[model samples]
Target: VTKPYRLRELIARIRAVLRRSGSEPANDVIMSIGEFRIDTIRRSVVRDGVELELSRKEFDLLALFASRLGQVVTRDECLDEIWWGRDLADTRTLDTHVKRLRQKLEADPSNPIHLLTIRGVGFRLDP
Candidate 1:
């Protein structure tokens, strides 16, 4: 396992390693939603035929949404997955990352179509 990675990442690595023989790891294991194609194993995101530069945290954040399109993922769920159980009760880290994702992916960040806020709940990705 790589240094400074979560259990989820280690599991993904193991899954990638488990693909053998005729399978190509790099071409396989991609999660997509709308124009966004998230290569979980490679930790990359490409939207509408163009690859958008994303920070590690931003990639992780998008990967989460890409996996569950059109679903309302709670704020706590995002926090636990990205922050890995840190005490971020009052932090705006997730919000900032989401905003960045919108700016990069959405045509209008103010009124996003892909990444959406769920009022007092969390967020949703409408693919």
Candidate 2:
């Protein structure tokens, strides 16, 4: 019983530390692009003021794109940053995540308004 309590305390301390260091901004909790808004702290995305459901990977991908809006983010960069430098197991993983993100956030997934794929390079999030 005492051991479990001690473990819980340790876990709580680690969580607190991670939360302090994580991406949640101190002042601004929102990232907005046109009708889309992302709450970084809440890990939620809203389009036209309506909440959109997203998987963990999808949310991370969107957050990364939003953080680097208007900048080209390469596959390796994304894999390293979002996947925590872990091997993606397949290069297609990034593509898949991007596709999902586009489907959710883009006005037209085929033509894509916000998420733009740069042929032979990578992707850019238009601001």
Candidate 3:
């Protein structure tokens, strides 16, 4: 049982929920920038017509970066989104993941052109 709810409020809430549920189909989400293409519904990433095999977290991390291309995403934001707000003593984990991601994403991991470091800031994905 719930507390009393106004008819208008209840109807609005139901409509909002329904709208979010299937207003837009998942298959419609095909994000692309330059040679990179990500089919979120299919959970696949393709660069230059070549598919890149990635771990679950790796894919998620890349997707996050891809969503905000050319913008530096802060460490705290990454930690919060990926690690669910877990406070890490250091960014070693994030660094490692980024390194691995760069390996798959960049032509030269050592001298990366796409995934770049901001030096004390965070990371940016340049398409």
CA-lDDT, candidates in order: 0.77, 0.78, 0.79
What TM-score goes with each of the models?
0.74, 0.76, 0.76
True-structure lDDT of candidate 2: 0.78
- lDDT digits (tens) for residues 80-101 of candidate 1: 6777545676758888888988
RMSD of 2: 7.2
After superposition, candidate 3 runs with Cα above 4 Å error: 1-28
- CA lDDT, candidate 1, residue 58: 84
Candidate 3 per-residue lDDT over residues 4-106, each given as its tens digit = 7555445545554564476665544788877889887778999989999988878878877876789998886677666655557787999999999999988
Ranking by lDDT: 3, 2, 1
Of candidates 2 and 1, the better by TM-score? 2
Write down the TM-score for model 1.
Answer: 0.74
